[model samples]
Structure formats: structure tokens, C-alpha cells
Target: MKTAVALTIAGSDSGGGAGIQADLKTFAFNYVHGASVVTCLTAQNTKEVTEVMAVSPNMVKAQFEAVINDIKVDALKTGMLFNQEIISTVADCIKSWGGDNIVIDPVMVSRTGAQLIDDSAVEVMKRELFPQALVLTPNIYEAQLLSCMSIHCLEDMKQAAAKIYDLGAKTVLIKGGAAEGKNKGIDVFFDGQGYTIVGIKAIDTVNNHGTGCSLGAGITAHLALGKSLPRAIASAKEYVTTALEYSLEIGSGCGPIGHFFPLIESQYNG
Candidate 1:
């Protein structure tokens, strides 16, 4: 039997908790073969991100060509394209290759309220990349930015999801993990027709550094394994929730969710 293949085009996290590392771990946990195209490198830990450097557009394009040329990627996801040039380069590569089952995790703002991408990059992402996405997953902060509205309730999330869906994503998932009150952990999914509210039990943890990236990669892996878009989203949500439940307490600050939680559990169970 052939293993399903999934690709991640994102940044490198020195902390090994997010970006390409997290995406690969999530893909592996889903039983998919993972490929990667690194667009940037970050000197970051659970504590803070100190520095970041984007790969040149030429190198980013080269990486994409090398990966997609040999491997048959059943699905792919993008995360943390830090600049306009990288975003445009990736978009062109996706167009040249084929945009099928592409999950775009708009990594504009961090969970710590820091902006990761510049405004120009955001514009390029929406204009060049979003329309090609099969699924666009944005956290509450990113959703607010994309939709130009504040999200404080489920209704607000729904509206934001709808508004973002208009921007050309076939489906939009507005993650409400950072929401307050009764809306926390309740995500709104909009697929141009109606809305579905996806909610899971909230896990209280400061170790959620890679939740967004992992979720997007999980969905891509599921898609590679032949699940429908909505089904993939549902499965990814469950995977992230479980991973969060077993989040690792590493470093002096916010840790990361356990992408390989099942394997870690088996070490103890056995």
C-alpha cells in the first residue's frame, strides 16, 4: 500500500513546537508522509520569538518545485509566509503546480497578540493565495483582521466567517479559542452556504504554541487520507483537542501541544 503524502510550506521554529516542525509531527501522527518547503526561519522558544529571517523568493520557489516535482502530494498546507515576496512566490508555485486540497492557515497574529506578518503580506495573501485555498483556517485575531470586525461572540464569529468566505476561500474556519465568555473553543465554519458551529471542551493550558499550525496540517493529512473537507476539519479539531490535553510543559514560558500524544501515552501504558 502506498502512504498518503502531504506537504507543508511554512517557517522553521527553533523551538520545535510550531511551523514546519509541528506540521510534520501532525502529519506523521495522522499516518501521512510529510514533505516540507521552508519559507522562513525563526529563532524562537516557548518564551518569545527573538528574530526571524525569510528565505529568498528564489529559494522558496526552488524548494516548492523540488518537493512537488518528485512527490505526489495528496494535500498541502501553508503557514507563516512572513512577507509579501514569499506569499507571492508561494502563490505562483501553487498555481504552477496545482491547487487542490490546500489548507491556508493565515498566521498573521500570534496568540500573544504580536503581529507576525506585515500588512503588505496580508494583502498579498488575501489577493493571491486565498482564492486557491480549499480551507482557510484563521484564529480569532486573524479572522477579525480579515473580516474587519471584532469577534466576541459566536454570532460575531459567524458573521466574520461569512465575510471572510466572501474573500474567495471555499471554506472558512474561524477559530474561537481565544474568545471570551461562552464562545471560547467554539469555532464557526462557513462554506458559502451556511454556518456550522464546532465546539470542543476547552483545555486550559499555556502550552498552545502550535495549535493553529497543527490543526491546519492535521486537516491536510486527513484530506490526503481521502476525507472530505468538513470531515477533515472535524477530525483535525478532535486531534488538536487531544493534543492540547497532553500539551508538553517545556521551556520557561508557553509550551506546545503534543502532536505525538498517542505515542507518548503508549510509552507510559506499555
Candidate 2:
């Protein structure tokens, strides 16, 4: 049987919890072959991101071209393109490739609410990339930024999802993981016509370092395997929830969810 291939154009996490590392693990667990184009390098662990250095725009283009030319990417996701130059380069490559099955995770805000990219890069992403996205997955903070409103409740999240849908993405998923109150762990999905509320029992754990990245990657992998957008999102949500249940207490700070939880479970049982 032929294998499906998914690609991740993101950054390298020295911590092995987020970005490219998390993305590849998600893809592998889904039984999809994973390819990567590293957009930036970060020197930090699960605790904090200390230093970040972006790959040159030319190199970003080269990496994207090399992978797209050789492998037939069934689906692809973009993570931390740190600058306007890199975002432009990636958007241009996708346009040139006439790429579809695109999942865009707007990684603008950190888990601690720090701004990761500058305002200018955010503008570039909105203008160049969002329109091309098959699904735009943004956490609550990012959703607030994009929709120009604060989200404090499920209603607010639904409003934000609708507003973001106007930004040209065919579908928008506003992650409420960081939300307070009873609605936490509930995500609002908007796909032009209507909204779907997806909720899972919230797992209490601090070791959710790559939940967003892994969720987006899992969706991409399922899309690569020929699932519909809603099915892909649902499956990915279940996967992330299970991964969170098996969250690894690896680092001193916030650790990472177990991307390979089934394997770990089997090993322990055996």
C-alpha cells in the first residue's frame, strides 16, 4: 500500500517538545510519513525560549522547494515562521506550488502570553497566508489578536471565530485550552456557513508543551490520509486529549504531552 506524506514547515525546538519535533511525532503516530522544513532555530528547553535565530529567506525557499519537488505532500502545516521575510517566502512557495490541504497555526502568542512575532510579521501572515489556509488554528490569545476582541466566554470565542473567518480562511478553530472557567478545553470551529463546538474533558496537567503544534500536525496527518476537515479535527482532538492523559513529566518546567502514548502504554504493559 502507498504511504501518505505530510510536511511541516516550522521551527526547531531544542526542548523536543514543540515545533518540528512535536509535529513529526504527531505525524508518525498517525502512520503518515513526515517531512520538514525548519524555518528557525530556538535555543531553549521546556522551560522558556531563550534565543531564536531564523533561517534565511533563501534557505527557507530552498528547503521548501526541495521537499515539494521530490515528495508529493498530501497535506502541510506551518508553525513558527518568526519573521515577515520567512512568512513571505513560505507564502510565495505555497502559491507557486499551488498547494492545497494547508493547515496554518498562527503561533503569535506564547503559552505565557508573550508575543512571539512582531506586529509586522502578523500582518504579513494575515495578508499572505491566511487566505490560503484550509484551516486556521489559533489559540485564544491569537484569536483575540486576529479578531480584535477579548475572549472570556464561549460566546466570545464563537464571535472571535466568526470574525476570524472573515480573514479569508475557509475554516477557523479557536482553541480555548488557555481559557478560564467551565468552557476551558472547548474549541470553537467556524467554517464559513456555521459553527461547531468541540469539547473534550479537560485533562489537568502542566506538561502540555506541544498541544497546539501536535493538534495542528495531527489534523494535517489525518488530512494527508484522506479524511474530511471535520473528521480530521475530531480525530486530532481525541489524539491530543489522550496524549495529554499520558503527558510526560520530562522537564523541570512544563513538560510535553506524550505524542506516542499508545506505544508507551504497550511497552509498560508488556
Candidate 3:
């Protein structure tokens, strides 16, 4: 039996479609094992997040040690490091043992537009963790937040990605879901040298709750299975597109894309 295990170091979303939930689902659907170290706990429903309490740095470190000692991680995905200490702790651990493929999703704002990270942790993530990531996946808002610049156009996205690269990430994926353009849901990928502009048509449904988390985890799964960076990212984007296409409207505000929608709800049916 061939089993691959990937670890997610992120927060828990009570809504069950994002965060640890979505990561685990993506892992299972991709035929990989999933483990997790929760960095924070959020009091969130389908509509919005009410409160978030970040776990202590010691606990975070302990969780990593436990995972490392028990099972070797094939790949790693990180999301929602809410504070400076937690971010620092994760970065240090990654630096110590970060040989495997790693995808860092800089989760800045929630689907409801609530801030999930502290302002103090931004600098720490840039200096400590971004350099260690195999790929840093930051959405339009997150890119703007990290680079401290307004993203008005695709050019702004490129500039933001370059600025983020200066902070140390080997590669930066600046998502263009919210970029100023006719694009309904196009995302851009940029390394230090050049950039690739990819266009994706919008999914008609409103169930886009955990698309970001699912995308990061899906990409990590492909990388763990030995896919190149570009291929892994392109494939992951396609996976998210299908999930969103079959998204189920669970909440009034915005719902979650089905991570296993391809299997659960066939594209033709749902």
C-alpha cells in the first residue's frame, strides 16, 4: 500500500469547509494522508468568524516535534498563523526541517473580510517564513497587505509579487481574484525572474468558502507526489475551479467549494 502523509499547520475553521477541514479533505481526495497542528481556534459559522484565539508558541512547537518524531511528512501546507510568536515558532521549525515541498498560504482576511492575522506578525512572516517556503500563495488582499501597496491592476500584482520576493520567498503566487480587471477569477504566478498570467473563468455558484485553503493543500499534495512547481500549481488551480463549479451554497454570505466535488457531485450534474 502506498500512503503519503502531509501535515497542515493552520487554524481550525468551525465552518468545516476551510482551514484544517478543507486540507484534510483535499489530502484524502488526492490519495494522501493528512495530519495537522492547529495554530488557532476560531469561533466561526458558515456566515462569519466571531472570535479567534491563537494557540501558544510552545504548544505549536510541541505539535511539530510530535509529528516529526512519529511520521515523516511528505509535504507541508501552512495557513493562519495569527500572531508573531506563532509565526516565529513555525518559521523556526520549518528552517530546521524543511526539505520536503512546502506551500505557505498567507491567509490575511476571511471570507467575511475579517482580519485573521496580527499586524505584528507580518514582518516576522516576511523575514522568517517566506524565505523557507517552496511557494508562497498570497491572495490579492494578502499581497497588498504584505507589500503595503495598492493592487490596482495586473502590473500592481506583478510589482507586489516582486516586492514579496525581495522579502525572501523563493517563489510568489499573487492571486488575482480581486485584481482590477475584467477577470472574474484570474490568478497570476510570479517567480523572481518573470511572471505567468493565467486566466480562469468564474464559477457561477457562490460557494467559494475554502477555495484558498483547498488550493494550497491541493498543490502541496501534487508536489509531494513528485510534480514540478508549475505543473502542480496549474493542476491545483484546475482542481479548485472544478470544486467551485460544483460548489454547494451552504451559507447565505458565501459557501464552500466542495473539495471532492468531482467525485461527490459530477460537473455535469451539480
Candidate 4:
């Protein structure tokens, strides 16, 4: 039998926590073959990002062509596009390839709420890449930036989702993981017509280093497996929650969620 393929266009995380690393792991767990095109490289660990070096736009374009020409991608996700040039290159390539089933994880800010890319890059992504997305997944802060709205509650999340949906994406999911109160970790999904609140009990852990990447990749993997948007999101939600439950406290600061929690559990049990 042939396996579904998922592609991740993103940066390299030396810590093996986020970016392409997380995406591939999520793909593997979902029984999909994972491919990647690295836009940049980050010198960081579970603690913090120390330095970043981006690949040339030409190089990024080459990688994309190499993969798409030979392999068949059922679903594709973008994460941590470092600059405007890379964003434009990726957007152009995706357009030329006629690739759909896109999951865009607008990774402008870190989990700890630190800005990762410049405003110019963010602007380029909003203009060039966002409209092409089948699903746009943004955290509360990212949603706020994209929607230009304040999100303090579920109602605000819904409003933000609608606002982001207006930006050309067919669907939008505003993640409320950082929201306050009892209803934290809720995600508002807007499918151009209605809303679905995806929620689970928020886990309190410092090992949430790659939550966004993992969730986005998980959704992409499910989509590659021919799941509907709503079903894909639901499966991705459960996958991420379980990974969080088995998160690793390997470093001093924020660590990474266990991308292969079930595999690890089975190995230990055996």
C-alpha cells in the first residue's frame, strides 16, 4: 500500500522540538511520509533561540521544486518562514505547483510570546501566503495581530476568527491556549459559515515548546490521510493533547512535548 505524504516548509530547530522536526514527527505518528524544505536554521535548544541563519531564497525555491517534482504531497504546512523573500518564494512555488490542502501556521511569535520574525516578513506572509491557505492556524497573539483585535475571551476569539477568515482563508482557527480562566486551551474554528470551539483541559507544563508546530503538522497529516477539515482538526487536537501529557522536562526553560508519546509508552510497556 502507498502511504500519504505531507510536506513541511519551515525552519530547522536544533533542539528537535519545533519547526520541521516537530512537523516530521507528527507526520510519522499519523502514518504519513514526511518531507521538508528548510527556509532557515535556528541555533537553539529547549531554553531559547540564540541565533538564526536563513537559506537563500533561490535555495528554498530549489528545495520546493525538487520535492514536488518527484513526490506527491497530499497536504502541506508552512511554519517559521524567516523573511519576506522566503515567504514570497514559497508562495510562488505553491501557486505554480497548483498545490492546495494548505495549513498555514503563522508562526510570528514564540510560545513564550517573543517575536520571531520582522514585521516585513509578517506583512509578506499576510499578503502573499495567507489567502491561499485552506486552514489558517494562529494563536491568540498571532490572531490579534492579523485581525487587529483584542482577544480576552471566547467571544473575542470568535470575532478574531471571523476577522482572519475575511483575509481570504477558507477557514481559521484561533487558538486560545494562552487565554486566561477556566476555558483556556480552547480553539475557535471558523469555516466561513459557522464556528466550532475545540477545547480540552489545558495542561500546565513548561514543555510546550512545539505546540503550534505539532498541531499544524498533525492537522496536515490528517488532511493527507483524507480527513475532512473538521475531522482533521479534531484528531490533531487529541494528538497534541496526548503529546503534552507526555512532555519532556529536558531543559531548564521551556522544553518540548513528546512527539512520539504512544510509541514511547509502547516501548516501555513491552
Candidate 5:
């Protein structure tokens, strides 16, 4: 059987929780070959991101060229594009090489609702990158920034999803993980036709450091493996839920979900 291949253009998490680490793990589980172009290097653990150093635009372009020329990338995901220059470079490369299955995880806001990048980067991403997205996955805070609306309820999330879809992505998934209510983690999906809400009963855990990255990577992996967009989203949601259910308590602060829980469990049980 032939294997699928996926690429991640994202930052590197030194702690191996989110970013390229999580993306590779997710791709591995889906039986897809994983490739990466590191956009930034961050000194972060489960606790917090203390420092970030972005790669040069030329280096970013070099990596993109190396991957595209050698590997047949079935799908790709972007995370933590730190600045306008990097965003523009990536967008140009995608346009040049062609981007069919691009999953854009707008990593603009942190878990605590803090802006990670500036407005200029966000503006550049929207203008240059969003149009290339086959799928756009943004958490609550990111959705708010993109739609310029406060999401207090599920209906609000639906509205945000529509607005974001209008921004150029063929499909928009507004993650409601941060939304407050009885159903605290409902994800709204809009594919230019209508809306669908995907939710698993929220798992209470502080060890969710890489949930967004993992979710987006999983979807990308499935897409590479020939799954439909909606099926990929549903499967990715389930994968994240399971990872959260067996989340790893690694560091002093918020840790990472167990990307390989099922694999480990199988190994141990057998």
C-alpha cells in the first residue's frame, strides 16, 4: 500500500508539546509521512512561552523548496507564523507550489487569551494566507479577532464561523474550547453552505497545552489519507478528546495531552 505524506510549517516547541513535535506525532498515528519547515523556535515548556526566535525568511523559503522538490506533500498545516514576513514568504511559496489541502491554524492568541503576534502579522495572514486554506481552525480568541465579535454562546460561534469563512477559507472551524457554558467545548463548522457543531463532553484538565496544534495536525493527516473534510474534522475531534482524556501531567503548569496514549496503552496491555 502507498503511504500518504503531510507537511507542517510551524514553530518548534522545545518542550515537545505543541508545534512540530505534536504535528509529527499526530501524523505518525495516522500512518502518514511527516515533513516540517520550522518557522520559529520557542523556549517554552508546559508552563509558558518565555522566548521566540523566528527563522529568516530566506531559510523558510529554502525549507519549503527542499520539501516541495523532494516530497509529494498530500496535505500541509501551518502554526505559529510569528510575523508578517514569515507569513508573506509562506503564502508566496504556497501560491507558487500550489496549495490544495492547506489547513491553517491561526496561532495568533495564546491559551490565556493573550495575543501572541501583532496585528500586522494577523492582517498579512488574513490577506495572503487565509485564501489558500482548505480548512481554517481557530480557537475562540482567534475567532473573536478574525470576526471582531464576542462569542458568548454557540450561536455566536456559528456567526463567527460564517464570517471567517467569508474571509477566504472554503471551510472554517471555530473551536469553542474556551467558550463558557454547560457545553464549554463546542466547535462550529461552516463550509459556505451551512453550520455544524462538533463537541465531545469537555474533559477537565490543565494538561491541554497542545490541543489546538494536535487537532489541526490530526485533521491534516486524515486529509492526506483521503478523508473528507467533515470526516477529518470529526475524527480529529475524537482524537483530541481521547488525548485529553488521557492527558499527560508533565510539567508544573499546563501540560500536554497524550498524543500516543492509545499506542502506549496497546503496548502496555499486550
Candidate 6:
């Protein structure tokens, strides 16, 4: 039997915590083959992103065509679509290739407080890419930007989730990772009919450099493996929580969650 394949169209995180690194790791964890089309490259460490260089829109298109023409993608997700042109390019590619299950991670800002996306691209994403999304996952900050609603509390979260759903996404996962530290990490998933809150006690780990990318990738991985939307997201949160728990200290500043920790544990402990 062949392993199902998933593609991640995102940037390359030289720090190895996020972007293509996280997506590829998450796909492997979920027992799927992973491929990538780099959208940009960043000079980033756990502490800060010093620089970014986006791929040409034409190059992006070429890469996508090269992959799909050769391999079948069971599921796909996008992250860090920086500018309006790239946003338009990717949106067109998705439609032209006839995408399968797609998870859109509205990545606006980085964990280090750096801006990974352009202000103008946000509108293009909503108008072009989001309507075709199977599931849209946004962290609290991104949710606020998308819905124009301040999410200071859980009630605000439910409202934000509903509004984002109305924004044309078939489903929305508004990750509650940034509420007051006293509150747990509760990610809310709202489909058209109802909602669910998958909560995990906040892990006080500085090695959480790529939580957003990891979660979105994990969710896409589950979808590729035949899980329903709800199951995929719930399972993804669990996967990231475990990754955070076993996270390692690598860089001088922050660090990365171990995507293959489970595999490492199994190999060493057994």
C-alpha cells in the first residue's frame, strides 16, 4: 500500500521550527508523505526573524505545477502567503489544479512578534483563497484581523468563530492560544451547524516556536489520512500538545517542539 501524500505551500523556516519544516514533520508524524513548494525564505531564529525573501510568483506557479503534474496530493494547506501577488497566484493555482481537502492557516504574524504577511494580502486571501477552504485555522490574533472582532474572552471567541465561518470558509478553527495565561489553550472549531472546544492546559514551554504551523499541518495530515474535519483538528491539537511537552532546547533564544518525539520515545524507550 502507498502512503497518502500531502503538500504544504509555505515558506522555509531556516530555524526549523515552522513553515515547511513544521509541515513536513507533522505529515510524517501522521503517517503520510509530505512535499512542499516554498513560497518564501526567512532568516529567522527562535528569537526573531531578521529577513524574508519571497519566491517569484512565476516560480511559485512552476513549482506547484511540477508537483501536481507528477504526484497526486490527497490534501493540502497553505501558510505565510506574504503579498497580494503571491496570494493571487496561489489562489489561481489551487483553482486550476482542482485542490483536494485544503486547510488554510491565516498566518499573519510570527511567534517572535515579526510580521510574516503583508497588510494588503489579507484582503486578497479572504476574497480569493478562503471561499474554497475546507477548513480555515486562525490563531487568536489572525481571527481578530479576519473577523474585525476583539476576542478577549471565550464568548468573544464563539462569536468570532461564527463570523469567520460566514466569511466563506466551510469551517473555522479559532485557536485560543493567546487568551490570558490563566485560561487554557482552547481551540474552537465551528462548522456551519455547531461548534466544539478542544482544550489543553497551557504548557509553559518556551520551545513553542511554531505552534500555529504545526497545528495547521497536523490537521491537514489527518485529513489526508481519512479523518473527518472535527476529528482531524482535535487530533491535531493533541499532537501539538504532546510535541510541546517533549520540546527541546536548541537555539540560543527559544526552541522547537519535537515533531518526532513520539517516534524517538518509541525507539529509545522500547
Q: All candidates' lDDT scores?
A: 0.91, 0.94, 0.83, 0.91, 0.92, 0.87
Best by TM-score: 2
Considering TM-score, which of the candidate structures 2 and 5 is the better prediction for this target? 2
Q: Which ten residues in a row have the lowest lDDT in candidate 4?
A: 109-118
Off by more than 4 A, model 1: none
Which residue ranges in model 3 land beyond 4 Å of their true spot? 111-114, 266-270
lDDT of 3 by residue, 169-269 (tens): 78888776555447557777888889987666777666788888998998988887778989888888888888887787776777788787757755557
lDDT (tens digit, per residue) of candidate 5 on 4-118: 9999999999999999999999999778999999999999987777998999999999999999998889999999889999999999998987858999999999768999999
Top-lDDT candidate index:
2
Error of 2 at 182 (Å): 1.2
Could you tell me which 10 consecutive residues in candidate 3 have the lowest summed lDDT?
Answer: 175-184
Candidate 3 or 5, higher TM-score?
A: 5
* TM-score of each candidate structure, all chains considered together: 0.98, 0.99, 0.93, 0.97, 0.98, 0.96
RMSD of each: 0.9, 0.7, 2.0, 1.0, 1.0, 1.4
Residue by residue across 224-250, what tens digits does model 4's lDDT show? 999999999999999999899999989
Candidate 2: TM-score?
0.99
- Please give, for residues 128-199, the per-residue lDDT of candidate 1 as tens digits: 999999989999999989999987778888899999999998999988778877787788899998899888
Q: How many residue pairs clash in each candidate at the backbone level?
A: 0, 0, 0, 0, 0, 0
At residue 238, candidate 2 shows an lDDT of 97
lDDT of 2 by residue, 1-270 (tens): 989999999999999999999999999999999999999999988788889899999999999899988999999999999999999999998888786899999999976778899999999999999999999999999998999998899999999999999999999999888888798788999998888999888999999999999999999999999999999999999999999999999979999999999999999999
> Quick one: ranking by TM-score, best first?
2, 1, 5, 4, 6, 3
Worst 10 residues of 1 by lDDT: 110-119
